[model samples]
Target: MERKMIRISGKRQITIPQKYFDLLGFDTEAECILRGNELVIRPVSERSGGEFAEAILADLISQGYQGDELLSKFKETQKKVRPAVKTMIDEADALAATGGSTASLDDLFGTEER
Candidate 1:
């Protein structure tokens, strides 16, 4: 196809010709890509409509697959682990609550008093 010349305005804006727009199915929301040395403009497809970051986040969300179910499962796992963690925390708190009186360096070293 023969390409037509377009004039860049003072504001550095190029007016895309109606013919090219119609041929390429370009709309007001179309995206333009400028590679190393090529300028390509095309209509955004459903599969590629969003910004790259949005697309990546969307893909990550989609891959999560279980949505609320996964969240519920995680909560369930936390519930199962909570008691053990709490027990450990309680033990540590009790140890700390001793005020270090029973935590002698000899006790730590498992040795008799010199």
Candidate 2:
């Protein structure tokens, strides 16, 4: 882990080290996350909400969505992906902290050898 003490400006803005910025592919925007007691600042993924675009569109189209309605619903569903993922991560972390086991494939998708 590379560690460097940086001075926060009067406006509370801190500059990212050039090495770290280039290494992490920092762009014009970043995502700030607070996990436990640590604050994490990472590059905003260009693929965020985009990876699921095809799947979301397929499902919506299969439901007979078209025209502006399809576009609107696609945008709406895409917006929910990030929040849903964050919730799952938080739940998983809580479960791990409590030493709780997560569901198996059989529990989630059912067993084929019924």
Candidate 3:
């Protein structure tokens, strides 16, 4: 894709070009990202919480985990992760309530990538 220049106004807002808006559709909101020295804008996609679950189940199924065995393992993982997930959500809520900036998911989940 060819790069297009955009000027940020004194208010620190840059108008997203009409082409991007047209392509992404103005109906949905776009998420702005700051990655190192780069800025990225992407439309928010519909959430399917099952995507990761699907991946894990697919891998396990490939390895012969199925039916009752699959369900049992899933339950076990959920039992293990449920509390941690709640804790993460609580922490996120506390931070957001205080208007704090989180650097990454690593900061949120306490799992930093090297």
Candidate 4:
């Protein structure tokens, strides 16, 4: 991680180093998140949930949605992608912490008959 000793202004704002800001693709706005005792400032992606856009559009289109309805459904599904991914990540982390499943390959898939 890159470390910098930056001074905070009287208004409780610190200037991000140009190198870091450019590297992180910072624009006019940033998302400030408090994780534990650490404060993280990240660039706010203009295209949040954009990764799923093509797939969502394809599915919605195949489902016979078009016009304003297609656009509406696309927006709704796009909003859901991030939260759903977060939930999956949380679940995965929990499983990892618990050592995941106990079943072996044989137990799960069964062995060939002798």
Candidate 2, residues 1-114, lDDT tens digits: the string is 779999999999999999999999999999998999998999998765888899999999999999999999999999988887676677666666776577664443345531
Candidate 2 stretches greater than 4 Å from native: 1-15, 19-23, 27-41, 46-48, 102-114
TM of each candidate vs. truth: 0.38, 0.61, 0.42, 0.60
Where is the poorest 10-residue window by lDDT in model 4? 105-114
**After superposition, candidate 4 runs with Cα above 4 Å error:** 1-15, 27-46, 101-114
lDDT for model 1, please.
0.60
Candidate 2 local Cα displacement, residue 107, angstroms: 7.8
> 1-114, model 4: which lDDT tens digit per residue?
769999999999899999999999999999998899999999988775999899889999999999999999999989987877677667665666778677455444446542
Q: lDDT at 101 for candidate 4?
A: 78
1 against 4, candidate with superior lDDT = 4
How do the residues 1-114 of candidate 1 rate in per-residue lDDT, one tens digit apiece? 777899999998888799887887876667777788998877865432223434334444575736776556444444444455446556655667777557754443335422
Give residue 64's error in model 4 in angstroms. 0.3
Residue pairs with backbone atoms closer than 3 Å in model 4 (clashes): none
**Each model's Cα RMSD:** 21.7, 5.9, 8.3, 8.4
Candidate 3 lDDT over 19-111, as tens digits, reads: 977887755577788899988888765443344576557766787888999988766654545466668889987877787685467766787
